[model samples]
Target: MTRVDDPATTSPEQARAAFRAGTVAPTSGWAPGFTQTNLIAVPRDWAYDVLLFCQRNPRPCPVLDVTDPGDTSTVLAPGADLSRDLPRYRVWRHGELAEEVEDVRGLWQENLVAFSIGCSFTFETGLRAAGVPLRHLEQGRNVPMYVTNRRCRPAGRLHGPLVVSMRPIPAGLVGEAVAISGAMPAVHGAPVHVGDPGELGIVDLGRPDFGEPVEADPGDVPVFWACGVTPQAALMASKPPFAITHSPGHMFITDRADSEYRVPVQRNE
Candidate 1:
């Protein structure tokens, strides 16, 4: 995987073009104002279960769009190839990660149905605009994610523990972060928990279940948000026969704007 210098100004088309050309990198800072998504593709036989799973747990698996069986196109980003536009992908076999690849075109199955789920990255620009410092971006690392003991409501055969991404925010700005993110329900909005990691069964913040460990500063509060990686955790737990997902942090950048997912707030006159 490589790093993109000055990704803040990158465009969705440009990011996808770089990915399509085999450039691998976490998409956190890429194309700042655009929406990013988590990619998950499963056999048509399991499409209903996937949809049901997302419906049962909207906080962690907010679906933006779903492709019909074997269709690689999504309305979220027209002309983008689901199998090739993402930076990195994970291939699952009978519940285990079989391989990590740059592209899934060769592994694409005719019966596969792909889901484009909303990502926390989509709301990051808003977080920045609100003056919330992003430690992972500042540290040049992928956001730290953890698998919790809390279980999600199961959909058919899909059942797994909840997974979350943690960002350490200054104690004073925690509320502002919450207020800014809570408005965008489509992108895993709001903090599921703040403060103690052990409360969620996370033993050590440095050793996360997924992504990289990030360093928190003094007076920083660890804030947890429902993560799109929840589906991957479900696949690992439920042992789906076959599935494909974006490698955590390596998301699919969409043409849509972050404003498209934000919930407008009404003010009192």
Candidate 2:
């Protein structure tokens, strides 16, 4: 893993340079405070179903931006190229992962539609600011993620169990973590479950379906939140003819701020 301190110095051009040069890696801390999105590239034929899937499962799949077919530029992140902004991407053909690539420029097609979904990293900064410690961030490991028995509402050919990321929160700070994160609805907003993994049908806390597992300290409860990986799992289950997504923890950094996603409400006159 090539660690680049001062990701602020790394512009979109630098990011593309790193990816094109075969330095793709997990982008957890890179471009902190910027909204990092999960990529879901699918054939135009399956675009509607994929969009509906994200709409129905907002927590696990919050839609931040979508690109027009064959267009690599997302208005959400103007000038940021999707094909090379992300550190790594996973290419799935007929539901099976065909290969991993640093850049997807070769696979770009006129019939491809790209969706940028919200990721938990947007909210982790809020959690850290609120004094909620994150084990994965501290350990420099991928956050633990799992496929739960809870089924996500199916849209067209898309349907699968919801995936969640687990974070160990101190017994005293669990409520604080929930309150702070809940304020940002754009990024999988709050904790879906506070304690007891079995309630969500998660059997072994240490054995996650995806990502690396972190140790939960004594008196710390395993907190669960809906994850963006849900769509990737759904794609694998539904076996779409062609699909592409960012590698786990490798996200496309955007210019949007996490605060911009806060839900706005109008007061009664």
Candidate 3:
């Protein structure tokens, strides 16, 4: 299995360079300490509603940055161009996925606002450091995500079922896992559910709505955490005229460190 020691994958700039040059791999385990985010772009006409949506549903759609209309770079990662940084982009038109691209420069316009949402990827750093095994990272696959029966708070034009990313954790270490990740509420916080995929309406843990599935060890439990992809589900449900988002697992790496977002939560789980 590949590890996080690759030099080219250890810095946001180097990682983005690799992405810009046609490397279309999932961003997991890359740039270890730096923060990675989910990208969502919308027309200025829908900016207010989008912001409100994020504010109301911070678990799955935590708001990190919202660029001014037409801007491509972000305050969190200066010198980084959102149009070309992520490994892939998902373009949405009227709630349907329209196109997938590497560089969004051609799609850039004067009235589009970019929103950076906190991703579960950011909290994985703490988990790894705390000795939690990440099946997706160790197996070299995109983290599996699913749409759940739970509904998110409805905003002006954005409302949809909640989505979550699942990770298999050793049954004994579940508390440690929660404490490590709970510290980073800015990055999706901790697991929303600890066991039983059926509770989330997930009939088969092997089949996910997005990304690849991992094999669970005998004592490992399927843990679900609020995922950033929830916003994409919203986009498809709301049917906005036009939008762009980072393809699942294609996160936007930032200059910030994971420590900046960590604040351990008092766990009762």
Candidate 4:
């Protein structure tokens, strides 16, 4: 886990520098205010179904932006290249991980479509800013994610269980945490459930379906939120012929601010 305190140089170039120079291992703290996105690259043939899947399961698969088939750029973030901006990427073939690489420039195809899903990092940053403590960030570990017994609303060929990330919040601070996170609906807003892990069919706190598990203190209550991992689980269940996703913890940094996704305030007449 590399640490850099310089906030002045956290641009895309600097981020690439950090990844290339080995100054950053995971992207949790590298660009504090930037929106980090979960990536899913697929063939144009499957783009409609995948987009519909995200539409049906908005919580776990919040659609941040979608690139046109064979196009890499999206209006969400100008001047950002999907192929190289992210620190790492995973390529899957026939539902199995085939390769992990720093960049996917060489693997680009004319028939590919890119989808950027909202990552928990955005909400985690909000929680931290609101004085809510996160154990995984402190430990420099990826947030613990699980494949739950809950089935996601399926669309076309996409179908699977909902995956969630657990955060052990002090019992007293749970309400505040929920309120702060709930306000940001664009980024997997709010806790799906609070309190019992068994309710979600999560048998063990130490074992996670994906990412690393963090220590839950005595008074800390485990809070579960719908996760972007749901799509990856769907990929495994549905067995798409080919797919690509960001390597866990490595995300596509976008120029959009968290405020852009804030739930709007309405005035009653």
Judged by TM-score, which candidate is best? 1
C-alpha-based local distance difference test score of model 1: 0.94
Candidate 4 lDDT over residue span 184-224, tens digit each: 87888889999889999999989998789899878999999
Worst 10 residues of 1 by lDDT: 1-10
lDDT at 257 for candidate 4?
74
Of candidates 4 and 1, the better by TM-score: 1
Clash count, one per candidate: 0, 0, 1, 0
The Cα local distance difference test for each model comes to 0.94, 0.83, 0.89, 0.82
lDDT of 1 by residue, 1-269 (tens): 33445678789998998898879889998999899999899999999999999999999999999998999999999899999999899999999999999999999999999999999998899989989999999999999999998999999999999999999999999988998899899999999999999999999999998999999899999999999999999999999899999999999999999999999865469
Candidate 4 clash pair list: none
**Runs off by more than 4 Å, candidate 3:** 1-9, 264-269
Q: How do these models rank on lDDT, best leading?
A: 1, 3, 2, 4
User: lDDT of model 3 at residue 48?
Assistant: 92
Q: In angstroms, give how far residue 130 of model 2 lies from its true place.
A: 1.4
Off by over 4 Å in 2: 1-3, 6-17, 264-269
lDDT of 2 by residue, 26-112 (tens): 666555566778889999999999999998989989898888899889876777788877888899999999998888888988999
